[model samples]
Target: MNILIKSATLPDGTRADLAIADGVFVESAGSGATVIDADGLQALPGLVDLHTHLREPGFEQSETVLTGSRAAAAGGFTAVFAMANTSPVQDTAGVVEQVWSLGEQHGYVTVRPIGAVTIGLAGERLSEIGAMARSRAAVRVFSDDGKCVHDALLMRRALEYVSTFDGVVAQHAQEPRLTEGAQMNEGPLASELGLAGWPAVAEESIIARDVLLADAVGARLHVCHVSTAGSVEIVRWAKARGIQVTAEVTPHHLLLTEQLASGYDARFKVNPPLRRDEDVAALRAALADGTIDIVATDHAPHPVESKEAAWAEASFGMVGLESALSVVQSAMVDTGLLGWSDVARVLSSAPAAIGRLAGYDTPFAVGAPAHLTLVDPSARSVFSVDHLHGRSVNSPYLGRELPGRVVTTIHRGVPTVLDGVLRDPQEVSRG
Candidate 1:
């Protein structure tokens, strides 16, 4: 599919014409090209998500690779790293390869399978990391995301094992002991609501321990869903010490607070539960100053029954892939804390670098793969379930008004979404 986009604003705020041909950017679209007038739209490098839960090979009721890929494309992402906590757990080479093959077959977005740090995520023994790394999937990131790698020795061993293959361990920094039976962020609010508190130290302590372990072994470490101010400070300190660590903050953590839990709305409930307003402020500041590496959608989706239960019995996640960019724009860009270039960095290139996915270093370069999204920044509307393209509508931004709308998203030279509408899956597959 050949495409020519005219008058689109680049990340650096420059207006230019972009021509795509044969799955790569070219000097011209040549003959019989589809021309799109991109006036008043921003053309950004395709976004990449480091943390996403596509529950396939087991829990299709929640989300499948194809449905999740459609959600990702609707949200302006061209690639996403599927978490390891699937039904069967993505621990072995065969499972990872299966996921890779599914992504290829669907062709909605690049689905890079994240291998598990421990077998079945039990945290007892290390999984077949080497085989998965060398498999067709070539898994570069291993994690026990839904559960923390709480054992220090096991954590160290996992880090060392992945470092041998130049892979990084993305840790879910939650101390199991401190967060047992916890429901919301630990504070006065939790006490008043008669719920167990998930203390900040639970997250901070694990991070503090892992950064030192990573330093001792000289292995790369990545922290997932950092939600507190203390966690931010610890990551900042680690980076200052020149430790090889990268951290991600989810969109919910940046824009929402634990106060929303007062209503017992399970949609606001998430792992490493939302913290105080001060923590949100600190997270925004850290992201602006580069203390936080990137914005990742911990895009967890669950069935209506799972989320409609009591607060304590409800699932710990929110569907985020459909609302990540709008939330980022509201929390970071609209606040003057970040620019479009910074957005491109946090949402695209930086995450691609972390996952070791290439073709993003020189965005929109001639002959580069045509992976990009066109967004209308001036558009504003109340977010509703209609915006969600996934199977489950468990989003937290349902009634909120958000800035920016994805106008068109092209992945590998094919239009997954165009003119603000998601293309039919069969059409995308054919293209």
Candidate 2:
């Protein structure tokens, strides 16, 4: 199929007409192409999420690749790196290939599976890192995301092992000992609310240690969902020294603060729990300055029952894929801290570079993959369950007004979304 997108504003503030045919951009539209009037919209490279939890092959109650991919499409993403915290865990070549195959069949978004750093995520022994990397999925990233790779010696060994294949170890930087039984961010509010506190140092301590380890071994390391001011400073220091370290900040961390915890609403409960206002400020600044390499959703979704529990017993995640771009626009672009080009770098280009996903950084050029998103920048809406395309209804932005609704998303020359509505792939296939 061929498509013509007319009068769209590029991220660099230039207006142009874009054409796609047979899944690649072209100089002009082919005959009988589907014409779309993209006037008053901004065209951006399709987003790529480095951290997304598509709970399949085990926790289908929460989300599956098919459902999660729809959520990603709704959020204007062309690709997302699925985290390895699934049933049986994505620790082997077979599991990674299964996930990769599911993504291909869905066709909603490209799903790259991240292999687990340790077998069973036990942090004791390394998994089949080389085999997974060499598998059909071509896994280029390994992580123990829900659980930290706590043992120092084991972490170092895993880092060195992946360096052999140019793979990066994305560590979930939390010290288990310090955060045991923690419920919310450690502070005066936690004490007043009578909930357990998760200290910032718990996350900061592990990040500091891992950055040094990465420098010592000359291995690539990626920090996931960095949530503290201290952690930001550490990452900045490592980068200044030319350490091969890249970091990601979640949308929740950028827009929401620990103050939301006062209501005891379980929807706000998240891993490495939301930090203070100062931490949010630091994260925004770091992202704008290029100290933080990318903006990852950490798009964890839980079932209704799982999230409805008491704060102490609730799950530690929120559905984020569908609302990531709007949150970024509200938090970064609308505030004048970043422009559209910066959003493209953090959301699309930089993440692609870090994950080593080919052909994504060259967006909207001739012969490149025709993966792009069209946004109505002036459109504003109150986010509600109607906007959610996933199985889970645990979005943190529910009831919050967000800017810049995604008008359309084209993946490989196919329209997954049009006119703010998601297209059913089955219906399109039948046509």
Candidate 3:
């Protein structure tokens, strides 16, 4: 459908009439085009999540590619890099291609499958990186996200190998030895609750080592879900030293903190568990100063049975895709640390560049691919499961008042979401 968005606010705070036709942004819309009153809405570049767990090809009970894509679209995302660690793991060319095809067939969001850096994600040896990269899927970002690549030699090899193709090795920086039986952020609260502590050093140490190794190998490295103040300092230092490194902070870590675990609500549970308020403050500062490159959902999902168990036995993840943008609005934009253009940079263009996804650098420009979202920044309401469009209901922000709503999301010139309602899959695919 040709689209004419009237009086939409651009990221730079200017108002304009935006036009989309034939799958690209155009200078004007024809008379037959669909007209959308975008008055009072901010038109942002479609968001790109560098890290997301769609849980398909194996964990469909949690989230299928189609359902996850719908969830992403509802959150104003145009593209999400689905993490490896599936049933067969996206380690081979066949698996990655299958995931890529599923996303295309689903037709809601661009699902770029992340190839596993190790076989079976066992950290035993490297996976078929070259084959997956060369495959039709064209996998570029590689990671064993659920499991950190603890072997320094293997980490070095993975970094060196991806650099040959100008690909990046995204590391889940956690030292295995220090985090045994860890449940939450290591602190007094853990002692009070009798839950095992996940020390900050466990995360910071590995990141420090990996950055040095990346520098030594002269390869690009991206750190996933950095949660500690010290981790931010290390990444900032690395950038100052001219190391090829980029880091991301999850929305949960930005607005929520370890105190939420006081009641043992497993919904608060996540890998690289929530940190102190000081950590959150530092993370916001780093992002504002451009030390943190982007915000990723790390949108892990699980069945009701998985999270309803005892805190110690429950799964460690929170479904974040549906609530990510609102959280960013509350934590960053409302706080006056960032403007809408910066939000576009962190949530869209930067992540797209890091994942090597093209066509996003010049967002909303005429002739550019028409992947964009319209947001009502004045909307404020308590978040609920009704806001979630995925198969899972594991979000942590339920009942919390959030500041923004994604009124419309256009993917490749198709309206996946319109007037705050997610379109049906059939209708979306037909477009």
**Best by lDDT, which number?**
3
Q: Compared with the true structure, what per-residue lDDT tens digits does model 2 show for residues 293-376?
A: 999999998999999988888999999999999999999999998999999899999999999998787889999999999999
In the range 1-431, model 3's lDDT, one tens digit per residue, is 78899999999999999899988999988898899999999999999999999999999999999999999999999999999989999999999999999999888999999999999999989999999999999999999999999999999999999999999999998998999999999999999999999999999999999999999999999999999999999999999999999999999999999999999999999999999999999999999999999999999999999999899999999999989999999999999999999999999999999999998999989999999999999999999999998999999998899999999999999999999999864575466
Candidates by lDDT, descending order:
3, 1, 2
> Any idea what lDDT model 1 has?
0.94
Compared with the true structure, the alpha-carbon lDDT of candidate 3 equals 0.95
Instruction: Give the residue spans of candidate 2 off by over 4 A.
Output: 426-430
| Candidate with better lDDT, 2 vs 3 | 3
The CA lDDT of each predicted structure is 0.94, 0.94, 0.95
Error of 1 at 6 (Å): 0.6
> Measured by TM-score, how close is model 3 to the native structure?
0.99
Off by over 4 Å in 1: 425-431
Q: Which residue pairs come into collision in candidate 1? A: none
